[model samples]
Target: ASSSSPKMVKAIRVHELGGPEVLKWEDVDIGEPNEGQIRVRNKAIGLNFIDVYFRKGVYKASSFPFTPGMEAVGVVTAVGPGLTGRQVGDLVAYAGQPMGSYAEEQILPANKVVPVPSSVDPVVAASVLLKGMTAQFLLRRCFKVEPGHTILVHAAAGGVGSLLCQWANVLGATVIGTVSTKEKAAQAKEDGCHHVILYTEEDFVARVNELTSGNGVEVVYDSVGKDTFQGSLECLKLRGYMVSFGQSSGTPDPVPLSALAPKSLFLTRPTLMQYVVTRDELLEAAGEVFANIASGVLKVRVNHTYPLSEAAQAHADIESRKTSGSVVLVP
Candidate 1:
């Protein structure tokens, strides 16, 4: 029993998969890592709306009774085969796949974990990977925007919204963001949004036309799906791109491809994982973000942090559209 003893650790998991109340904090045994895995001693966990999708069953999972955090910054407590850069006590951060980050210790793939720069805070690393990568793909891959391009981004004060604003601004494009109220507009403007549309009061499509002198923007990054999809498409200039990255309001109904013809527009939906399928690719994508942060070209604003046990409350805050910017969970 001594040589084969099990170790116990704390984790947050859900039961019955309903609302926020289902996120139960409990003690569970931590076990040895499998091949090519490492046990991470988490310092911070990145909380995202995707976590809510898992909790709400919008994204199907293999089973229930799960721990839903997607990304974390941690120390490498132990490592198993094929890992060299990470060793005991090495500070590191990882994002994407095998979502069990809401814990004191959990096993994850060696390749999936990336080393955190000593200069950057662990919480920022935890917060940036997923959201930053999403922004990277949206700008670089989804539809490449050039200088002087005008764009509309929704929820522009939220996690990814802030990053997109900074990235677009640095690229010399005019960035327009929409929020539900004036407070978020200020936040978005503070995040580098050139123009902020208060959607609750203004007709955003009309506002987009107003901002562009009736020519419309070159693209619209719409995450507030159902409520804004049609109008988002209408906000584009001739041959503009519509990048629908998330479903904050709800998933919009399918669009007919022919609709793009009226304005000679383009549309595509992109996810981060698809953008970085290989280790070399993932690190390259991350390296751009790391360098941007280090150089001060990009700013990672973590607007909130909650204890891992209080994840349900975090999800509730996100669902309410009240909280702005990134939310992190410290385990």
Candidate 2:
């Protein structure tokens, strides 16, 4: 393919940060891959809370009127010059930086993507790549969850949370999950959560204390920022790891060093990008995730999906806490 011309495509563009209305389905121009890049015609786009964060201005974007997406599965419609092992019609998926996957077609760095297993559906691949990789590093690398280690996951029924519960259970850990409603609690239990707490009606910290016989959890994965951050610390055992990966509710206040003195808590806020900074790291993480999906070790739930044009409604549903499992956008 030549890089002399640009192609017009339909995409979800956010001109200014605000509500879901800001996500407008409009036309945009995308150029051919210059070098070390491939043009992907997206089959399915992933919907994540991070997308919402970027859309709402909670996370800064480098430019305005930008497409909002980070995960997608598609085919290599065109490969850049001088690139080998990738050809037209190859199926692939990518997650993380250089974020622009909401369009019908996009130009991506060739190395950022990995081949999707033939057995996995493109929609499922799109649904799990980002969230599954997040779960991978969190359970296997971040704290190395082991048998007899009791871990608490907030928003247990979310895209990443569901994968965490299932993978942690497979790793022989006792998984305790917290959710807002009974329906989500059931889903969490079905996802292998040993215990499900409805935080809306009960004191999660107290429940966790009782479940662990007052010893507390080895690690607390808190995504619901302000509302659950402090309580997550309270639910940890001495020297426990407090992993705050997201702030779906809102960012928590700054922590005082004194906050960790009582439990000697180890607090870390990690992102998937930092965990997979190199090509080898990217392949390793993606390989593990795809292998798990292929072996049935991880079961992705694409419980909700919307047309790419209806991304606004999808965002509204997720932000209002009305959707569960994974949400994907069909192109």
Candidate 3:
């Protein structure tokens, strides 16, 4: 097809925010790229818990009848006028912004797209773009994990958690992870966690303290919120950093200043959008993620996949906590 060709593409549209049932598989007319935008035929789309937030109305929709995806791997089929340095047929993967990747094809700003290395599979690229880049920013920028630093990661078998465990382990950090079940505990261990705590079976704060010889961890990378927030704070050493990035369980309540006064701890709630605001930052973080994958330092485990039309079932599985590692929607 030519860059100017208009076609009907299968897309998952949300007419009303609710459960997975709200995701309607329908055909949408897609036209040529507008100014500063490029049209891509997506090969695969990444599934994150944040997608559920958008679908369930936890996160407000910018408009009605919107496509709900933020990360995908695809090839540029059309380049809008005035967009330079990007040619048609180039493979690209992108994460963050514009919120319309849940389709066979999508229009995205050229600047937001990052080149996908040929050595990496499109499915893997799609799986990792958002989650891997998130781990990149969390470990590198947020707390700056180093050799011998002990850290605790919640939901260790999750999309971002699995990547964080492996990356931190590679950086020589002593990785301790918390999971809900024994099965997930095994997966977390395989992902380079030095110690896996079954939060369902035991007290994680005690285990984290036990694992570190009562010293506690230098940082706590907590994605499971509410249920684990105070426990996460307890696992931290005095003046330790607590990076609260997501709320899978539920949002935590307001924190009083006195909450941190005991340990004089540092607390941060960071988002991927804030970390990769500029084009350079996006490229830099993405470059490292792709490089690590290419070199085998970062292994992307896409454990689950579904056709684009089955996005609803996929969402249900993720929300139920039945899926682990990364999940992708093949278009």
RMSD to the native, candidate 2? Answer: 0.8
- The total number of steric clashes, by the backbone 3 Å criterion, in model 1 comes to 0
Show pairs that collide, candidate 3: none
lDDT of 2 by residue, 1-331 (tens): 4797878899999989999999999989898888899999999999999999999989999998799999999999988889898999999999998888999999999989999999898999999999999999999998899998999999999999999999999999999999999999999999999999999999999999999999999999999999999999999999999999999999999999999998788999999999999999999999999899899999999999899999999999999999889999998
Task: Please write out the lDDT profile of model 1 over residues 208-262, one tens digit for every residue.
Answer: 8888999988888988899999999988889888888889888899999898999
lDDT of 3 at 5: 72
On lDDT, the leading prediction is 2
lDDT at position 228, candidate 2: 97
TM-score of each: 0.96, 0.99, 0.97
- Any runs in candidate 1 off by more than 4 Å, and if so which? 1-5, 81-83
- Tens-digit lDDT track of model 3 for 1-331: 4555777899999998788999999998878888888999999999999999999887888999999999999999888877889999999999988898999999998999999989999999999999999999999998899999999999999999999999999999999999888889899999999999989889998888788889999999999899999999999899999999999998998899899999999999999999999999999999999999999999998999999899999999998889999999998
Q: Relative to the true structure, how large is the alpha-carbon lDDT of every model?
A: 0.87, 0.94, 0.93
The reply for model 2, stretches above 4 Å from the true place, is none
Candidate with the greatest TM-score versus the true structure: 2
